[model samples]
Every structure is written in structure tokens, then in C-alpha cells.
Target: MTRRVPFAWFARNILVGTLLGGAYGAIHDQVSWSISPEYFTKFKFEQFAWAEIGLEPRLAASWIGFLATWWAGAIAAYAVCRMAFRHAFQDGASSWPLGRVVRRLLAVLMVAMAGGGCGFAYARMRAQDVERLWGGWRTYAGVQDLEAFATVGSIHNFGYAGALLGIVLVAVHIKVKGRVDRSSPQSLPPPGR
Candidate 1:
């Protein structure tokens, strides 16, 4: 039998995931900028307006990219969590023992990591293609530079970290709920007559 989670709980998870994702996106973009300002500048110039190249435009593009990935990561994490919970419920594991919860959260983290790795690979390939098409307009320091920036700047890192944080938050929530449930009048001894 499947147990339904309260709507409030579900909504809270989604909101938390969204905020974490946005934070990750913003930080990752900044780090990427710091590591290779030229690459980002070139990428933004190519993607946006080639003639209008400036720091402000690059920063604006970064912001847009961050917001886009943030929403995407948040939605993805929320969906995965909802599915995980539903599967657990179907398997009659709604009680959420610490071990079970950890395992589930780990599974989510792995998914995020794998997704990030695949995304990095795809982006790298696309960047290379763009470079080739444009007759190598931008000069890359080396392959390692691209790899480093892609891995570090990717939203996957944020997703993984966010998932870990989400797990901890959920665990704490469960513990607090357990305590409240246990201390409720239903569990407490009846009043002395």
C-alpha cells in the first residue's frame, strides 16, 4: 500500500530545491568567470552579439545562464525526489528509517552527478563544434582549461551538493516529526485520575 505524503511536505521540498539550485547556479557561474574570464567572454560574445562585446553584456549572459540552469536543476531534483518517495511508499517503506533515507538520498546524488557529467560532455562537444565552425575565433589555452571549467562550472556540482543538503534537511525534519509524534497525547500516558 502506498502512503501519501502531505502536500505541504512536497511543496517545501520543491521550494528548498529551487533555492539551492539557484544558489548553486550563481556560485558556479562566478567561479567559472574567475577561472577563465576570456572563455566566458568569448562564449557569451558568440552566443549573444558578436559586435557588442563588453563586460556588462557578458555578466548579463552569465546571469541568464544561471537562472536557466537553476530552474532546470530545481525542477529535476524535485521530480526525482517525488519519484523516490513514491517508490518507497509503494514498497511499504514510508517510515523512512535513517539507513533507508540515506540510501535514497545517495541514489538521488548519484543521478545528479551522472547527469552533470553527461551534460559536461555534451557541452564540451558543442563548444568544440562551435569553435571549428567559427574557424577557431577564440583561442583556448588547452583542453584541460575547458575540462576544468566545465566540471567546476557545471550545475551538476550544485545539484549534488544541493541533494546532500536536502537529505540532511529531510533527516532533521523526520527526527523532529518523530519527536513530536511520540510526545503527542496519543502516545503519552493518560492523565492521572
Candidate 2:
């Protein structure tokens, strides 16, 4: 029979998983940086130029703060997952293996990516609205802006890549954890025994 895990173990596992996942997400952000492409200059994009914004310390601070925001997002997501599955990892129950925990973690990532993709698509459809809001008087009013932002391209690439990566990671994790033997309550031990 598999050994039981204490309530404290569950708490610890959740906390550690959240922190680790948050860190992983943070690292991911740093890996995907790309410079603005030349195409942006050809179109009526002079108004949105970074040089016009005048780089300021506050801007730098806010950008840095974005990283913390990303970390918090990741941590909160994992925490929510743990809370949602609290009943499954109760004290006196068989402790989940590391591989199982990893599988769950990856599963969450995959779901998040899928959700993000939907959001991305929605955001894309409304991209012109977003540009209008940000551009104000500086927007290209007459001609159709053909030159696309490089960031848009990267966003598309990352969206698909993130989904694929999430699936692969989840698959590997689940494979290592093995499959559920049955669907009955018998699959789990009797409570309080």
C-alpha cells in the first residue's frame, strides 16, 4: 500500500510548487525578448516611437514592476490549483509522487496557455481599437498601416509555442506519473482509516 501524507506535506508541496512555477514563468519572460523590427519605421508609426516617449525612470520602474506582476500571477495560479485539489491530497492519504505533482503543474500550464490563446485571439481582433486608444492624435489616419509591429509577430509565435510546450511538458509529466488504475472510490483509500 502507498504511504499517507500529512496535511503539512500538502501545504508545503503547494507552496513550493507555486514558488517554483512562478520562477519558471519569470525565466520564460526573460528568454523571449526581441528588438523592434524595421517594418515599424516604414509605416505611419513615427508617432508611436519609443524615442518620442522620452525614457524616464518611472517608466523603467514600471517595467520592472511588470516582472513582479508576472511572478505573482504565476504564484497565484498554482496556489489556486492547490486549493482546488485540496481534498485530493488530504492528510492520511497516499502522498502524490513528485512526477504526479509535476503532471498536475504541467496540466495547469497547458490549460492556462489554452485560455491565453483565446484571450490573444480576442485581443488581436480588437488590436485596432487598442492602437486607437494608445495612439490618440498620433495615429496614421489616412493610409492603411501595412507595416506590422514585430512584437505582434513575436506574440503570435509565443502563443503557439507556449501551447505546444505546455502540452509536451504535461505529457512527459503524466507519462512519468503513470495512469489512473480505475475510476471508482476504491482507487483511493478509505477516509479516516
Candidate 3:
């Protein structure tokens, strides 16, 4: 039988996922800002200073990036959790400790890797735009190369952060909710049960 998952379960997962994702994005931005204030300052100046935009615009840009990353992480987490829960319900494998753990871990890793890849692609595109606009890294921001920043700085950093945060938040939700119960009339038992 197909068991209907509760709306509360989805609500909880999505809420926690969004909060964790946003937190990760904020932390990443703050840490990056702190680590290389000069780079950020110069980059911001070059990007927005000539546009007559003030600090508010810069802050808004950071927030936009944060919100984008947060939504990406949230969607990834929600999708993974929903799929895992459905799989468990279908196979009655939720009781299998090792199996469940492994499945969840795999899901988390997949989400992380996907996020990283997408981030890399986005960074590459942005790098291209920057190069085209400024005639290369040296002319743009006095940096020798932006390839590293595009790949490692953007992809690896955001990907790992999102994955780590997603896993932790999802695990906490699972723990709090306990096993998926099928005893209620609103639920259904596993096939052949």
C-alpha cells in the first residue's frame, strides 16, 4: 500500500532546510568577506562603484547571492528527503539501520556533488562575462587569474557548505520524527505486510 506522508513532515523539512541553507550562505559570505576584505572591496568598487550605487546595492547583491544559494540548497534537500522517504515506505526498508543510513548518505553526497557542479558552471559563465567586460583578470581586478576563484572559490566552497548543512539538517529532522509509522488510517502499510 502507498502510505501518505503528512504535510507536517514536508513543512518541517522544508523550513529547516531553508533556514540551514540561508545560514550557510550567510556564513560563507561573511567568512569570505573577512578573509579578503581588499579583494571584495576592489571587486565591489569595480562592479558597482562607477554605477553610482552605494553600499546598499553591494549589500543587496550579497543578499541576492545568499538567497539564490539558499533556495538551491533547500530544493535539493527537500527533493532528496522526499525521495528517500518514499523509497523507504515502498520497500519497508526504514527499519534497516545500515541500509537507511547508507541511502541517506548517498543522497546527501549526490546533492552536494550536483550543487558543486552547477556552481562551477555558473562561476565559469560569470568569469567569462567578467573577462569580456574588463578585458581579462589583470585589467579587471589586478588579479593574475580568476580561474581558481571561479572553480574552487565558487563551486567547491558553496557545494561543500550546502551538502554539509543539508545533511545535518535532514538528519536532525529524521531523528525528531522517528520512524515512518504506518499504523494510522491515514497511512498505508508496506506491500505484502
Candidate 4:
């Protein structure tokens, strides 16, 4: 019978997964920001910065967008863990209870998503600062715009990547342990006659 998820397990998994996801998101945000230009003068994408329109609207949109993206990443992470736990980690001697695993995975996903959201918030805040410094994307338009967009996108992407990576890692571990097969052992040859 499948076992129920324990409260402690849920708490621990969420704490750890969230921390890991958040870290990845932050690092990715930094890298992307460094590479992308604020204004795509060559592409006219700067016209879409929204900051050029109104400060309050842009600020509100940024927050809403960031939250949505981060929540998505969290859900993705949780789904990945659930699939891994149910299909890959089940039926092993050391296997956790199905319910407990599900609970823990859910917790982890939620925490991870929260972290992703925080990362986005930080990125958007930085973007706002960039906008303020450059006077609405004219002076350092391309660079600042690119950095801001990149920062938010990168963090969201990284959160998803981390969850996917976690799935792969767990799957590999199950494979290594030969836990995928649980069929009854073949009968020995007539007691070695």
C-alpha cells in the first residue's frame, strides 16, 4: 500500500527545493541582464518597455508579470518532482510513502515558486532603477532595457530549469539503484539438483 506523506517531510522538501530554485533564478537573472541590451534599437523593442508610457502602470505590470512567471515555475517544479517520485522512486526498499512523497514534492514546488517570485521582484526593481537612471531609456536605452528584460526572463527560465534538472537527477538515481524493476525473481533451478 502507498504510504501517506508526513508533515515533517513536506516541510523539509519545500524548504530545500525553494532555496535551490531561488538561488538558480538569481544567478540566471544576473547573467542574462549582463548580456542583453536595454534597447533593441536595431529592433524597436524598446518601444515596448512600458516605462516610457507611465511609471505607475509599468510598476504594476512588472509586479503582476513577475508574480505570474514565478508561480508558473513553482508549479512546474512541483509537477516534475511528483512525476519523479511516483514513477521513478516507487517500489523500492527505501522508497517513501506515496502520499508523503506527493506532499513533500508539492511543498518543495511551492517554496521554489516563492523564491522564483522573489528573484523576479528583485530583477524588476533593478529595472526600475535603470529606467530612472537613464531617464526613460534614451541615454542607455538598449543596454538598460535589455538588462531589465533579461533579468526577469532569466530568473523565470532558471526556476524551470532547476526543477527539470531535479527530475533528471532523481530519475538517474532510481536507474542506478535498479528500482525500476520489481517483478518476482525467477525460481532457482530445481534446488541446484
TM-scores, each model vs. reference: 0.45, 0.43, 0.46, 0.38
Candidate 3 achieves a global lDDT of 0.55
**Ordering by TM-score:** 3, 1, 2, 4
lDDT of 3 by residue, 139-190 (tens): 6566544454344456646577658665765565564444444444546655
Report lDDT (CA) for all predictions.
0.52, 0.44, 0.55, 0.46
lDDT of 2 by residue, 1-193 (tens): 3243355656655665556455544443332222222223332134334434353433432233243334434453344334324434333334455555655666656654554455456556766675554343234432233223433333435544564455445544444333333334656677987
- Residue range with the least summed lDDT across 10 consecutive positions in model 1: 134-143
- What stretches of model 4 exceed 4 Å from their correct place? 37-73, 88-179, 184-193
Tens digits of per-residue lDDT for model 1, 1-193: 4566656655655655565556545565665566555445555445545334355844654664456455644564455455546533433333443354434444544555555556566556666554444333335433335544454444445545555555545445545555665566775657893
The residue pairs in collision within model 3 are none
**In model 4, how many backbone clashes occur?**
13
What lDDT would candidate 1 get against the real structure?
Answer: 0.52
Model 2 CA deviation exceeding 4 Å by range? 1-8, 35-86, 90-93, 136-193
Candidate 4 — worst ten consecutive residues by lDDT sum? Answer: 37-46
| Deviation from native of the Cα of residue 138 in model 4, angstroms | 10
Among these predictions, the greatest TM-score belongs to 3
